[model samples]
Target: MIQRDHIHMLIQINPRQSVAKVVNLLKGGSSRVIRTEYPEIEEFLWGDSFWGDGYFVESIGNKNETVMRQYIR
Candidate 1:
């Protein structure tokens, strides 16, 4: 879900995939699309990057899947 200043996503990653790599792919890919589709965004940017430098992640178990999905929603 997209919010005013942030977004919430509930994703399940493969065991071999690193969270950092996933975040990078998501940010980098989305940045390209967003910038290409809306060049006006450059006016509001403070730097060269579209996304912030930091990200927050957490690990959830099957028992808490419902709770996590609710939180993301």
Candidate 2:
């Protein structure tokens, strides 16, 4: 999980569970934790009283130097 004010998650888990189910669970738990840390973060975590409505999932591949540097920076 990568979190700023919002978040970007890159997860690798077992194949038995459906991705949608896993995403919902993770989103719910993370949202709760974020709220605990900073109540104000709730607004960012759930813009307009909703957390992310969509997610992008992909398999990892060889690192792109440009993207890697951007992430580190």
Residues 1-73 of candidate 2 have per-residue lDDT tens digits of 3465455545567878788899899878866786778877655543454465887676556867567546644
Give the clash total for candidate 2. 0
Residue pairs with clashing backbones, model 2: none
| lDDT per residue as tens, model 1, 1-73 | 8998888888889989999999999999999999999999999999898998998887776557888878778
Error of 2 at 39 (Å): 1.6
Backbone clash count for every predicted candidate, in the order shown: 0, 0
TM-score of each: 0.88, 0.56
Model 2 C-alpha lDDT versus the unseen true structure: 0.66
What's the lDDT for all of these models? 0.90, 0.66
TM-score, prediction 2: 0.56
Off by over 4 Å in 2: 1-6, 42-50, 61-73
